[model samples]
Target: MSASPKYSVELIDGPSRVQFTSASSILRPDGYHPAGAPHLISSATAEVYGNPKATKTIRIGNGGLGPTGALRQLCLAFLGERPDLRIDWVVNHSRHTQVALQAGSIDVALTYEREEEQAAETEGWSRTMGILCHDHFIIAGPRQDPAGLRGLHGSVGRANDVEVSKVKPLSTVAFANIARSQSTFHSRGDGSATMHRELGIWDSAGVPPREQGWYKVIAGTPLAALQRAAADVAYLLIDRATFLYAHHIGAVRDVEVFVEGGSELMNTTCILVRTEERRGAVLEFVEWLQGTEAQAIIERFGKNWELGVPLVTPVSQLEVAPHGKRS
Candidate 1:
């Protein structure tokens, strides 16, 4: 499952180095079972691959989360539990989940962008099969939260408690305040889903980071950016899981989640399947993901994630309703 080599970011998996024009890059690891390899599909696996003793492949993809070891942990656990299905898991740009699914480069995609999920289903090429988790963001900053962003909740989950018409989400307001205060702020600047969402927040705040001396873009993954922000005592919006992972690993010691949760801060992940293939089988796997076993794995998996912190909320356990609006 290779894409055209016009990428803006480098896809590094072990020894392979591939680039593409799309912000999303594909990481096809070396020595993995080749696509279309013959394997004996089992009963449970047949629900996804179909038929025993047949050659079939299912390509699963996510945004650049593979480097975090979160997606890899989930994929390995799924394969370990099933043992009957062969998967060539993929990592691409999160912002391009819909494009990859539409291009048929990946059979299924775990996407954080709710708009993309709705668009693909509306276009009739894809269907959202399950809600994996609602991973929200954290306004990572110094201990004091000099920007005064603490306790600022977005419109999500606050309608019943606050004035529904007057509240603006923190995703927008926080960034604007960060800019107005001229406090330091770091950005990944990479094409990953995190970067896209950060940009969207800034845009919603009506203050793009363009030419701002205070806004700095660190070159690396989300973990790397957050670490750099810690060193600089700058504020940056980061995914909660990644921040917790960094904390658990002891890599980022200074920054913490000052503010989080809201419709705008919700990075709700959905398991999407291309409807053109064995949709029923993929749907079966999706069902398992939302099941207890997979949900447990999700709750437990994460390299830098701190245990008992609930970095990522399983769909079954989230306070917000599945397939429901956050704000």
Candidate 2:
């Protein structure tokens, strides 16, 4: 425990959702190891795409991830909080977090969303789930709106004041409004998790931007794309954490969060371990991540970022995570 909670994190259930992970594996086609190949296990002081390492440590598959060092900071904080447990985190973006942990080449892994469902779907792998934290989506665009994107939905994107008052998911409506007005919208088109969610919201709104002239797919990392969106004065879906990083760097001063809050905008990351592996260290870290101590670290994380808003919201339980819980 930090013993002095600077910022309070909304307490949620620990590491619950298991969305598709948003990182990449660094192994080559035939066999290429970062540290001259492996001897045993499945990772190292690095992440394991599939290469076997030589340590039995709990290999959390997140590091130096996101724009503002959120996950990497979390890893550092965890180590600070619990010195007894040593974690070798490799920044992983491939689907192998599940495969390595499932195949017993590793102990546990932390990855993005719906992991519980996907874990269940995978025939023979046994895994237990916990809610780690949430990095939510913020619909951002130019401060000057072309589609009345902000005023039409108000602060939180609820369609209460318009003729389309019947309402759809406000997030969906936000995108639909962009299309209805043919407002320029940027798509990563790289099929990243953020991109996947953006497209899903469009589908949910029944207005896919398949061939619309207003829809333009942009290329680059999330930060680069965000900078592009700001330059073009276009609208795009961006993760709050990355947005915080971009904001810190002054990459998106012209953009503002138009639609946020509500579960539809949530992007969850979960901590997973084979229930059978049952490593005391893994279990301790997972439980502690959701406990008061680690949550305090997550709570005060953004104070370091120098941003007024916590990049990621604590929602599942401040008891699933409530960034909306300002203490």
Candidate 3:
């Protein structure tokens, strides 16, 4: 830690509820911290009146829910004390940071999007370089199904592919292809980067726009839209972190994650490093992440493995995508 602390940079995809608790445990007193994501958009106008040159490092922890978790709070505190400094922050998804890092664009990334490229760092790409966190997916739906999710539930349609509804131990929403319902399926709106990933899954499944009938695009955070789903019993997709918090607060509960304990299921976060400067301060940060302290924070923070959702392989394994990008 530099005593001068003169630079400010945004950290993307962090500061979850658990991360906040863990952050409070280790952050040094008198340090500056700032928390702001689109969820905490109010923080954006907090004012940066301090000397830009005086700050050594302005760290931004990326997390979508709100000014959540400890890392972001600490960063806000640091910035509050000294607003003047060179600051660069990118509070987006992990994939964004991963691309930036590999492309040599960012200094560091606190992300959940697993980078397949990092497979080179390990043998056979089996061991990905990342600090794992708890994450999972859930499907939301209407209590009654006009699209036939209820009828299709646990009922297999394909034979050679030998698909069975499987009637998952936990029930979320029925998985339907794009060809099935255009107006039936729902997700975040067009600008939402995450929606791109959802769209890709449909693409991978060979679900086409023509296949969809009742699909609708709603603009809002996962939790917000999830709430809407609950009210209307409309179907929606959600990440585990958001699901946990939402479920905890009773923001939404009827929906559940149908997929669990399979080769395809995974939930984890990672620290991304720009390929260009994989040395010095940047490397130190990456190494620090892998170290006991950083890993401890991530391990103990927002994501909960005890909930029984294991952090498995990289996102590359899933139809997970960025900007509707395909693998």
TM-score of 3: 0.54
What is the C-alpha lDDT profile of model 3 across 141-190, one tens digit per residue? 65554445445445543312434244532221244422344335666753
**TM-score computed on alpha carbons, candidate 2:** 0.68
> Alpha carbon lDDT of residue 286, candidate 3?
50
Candidate 1 Cα misplacement greater than 4 A, ranges: 1-57, 81-84, 150-166, 279-281, 299-307, 319-327
175-203, model 2: which lDDT tens digit per residue? 86787778899987753467667888887
Residues 144-171 of candidate 1 have per-residue lDDT tens digits of 6777766555432222122222356656
In order of TM-score, best first, we have 1, 2, 3
Ranking by lDDT: 1, 2, 3
> What lDDT score goes with residue 216 in model 2?
91
Model 1 weakest 10-residue run by lDDT: 38-47
TM-score for each candidate, following the candidate numbering: 0.69, 0.68, 0.54
RMSD of each: 10.3, 12.3, 13.8
Once fitted onto the true fold, the runs of candidate 2 whose alpha carbons sit more than 4 angstroms away are 1-57, 63-66, 81-86, 92-107, 119-122, 154-165, 304-306, 315-327
lDDT of 2 at 24: 17
Off by over 4 Å in 3: 1-54, 58-89, 98-106, 112-129, 132-134, 142-155, 158-173, 177-183, 189-193, 209-211, 278-282, 302-327
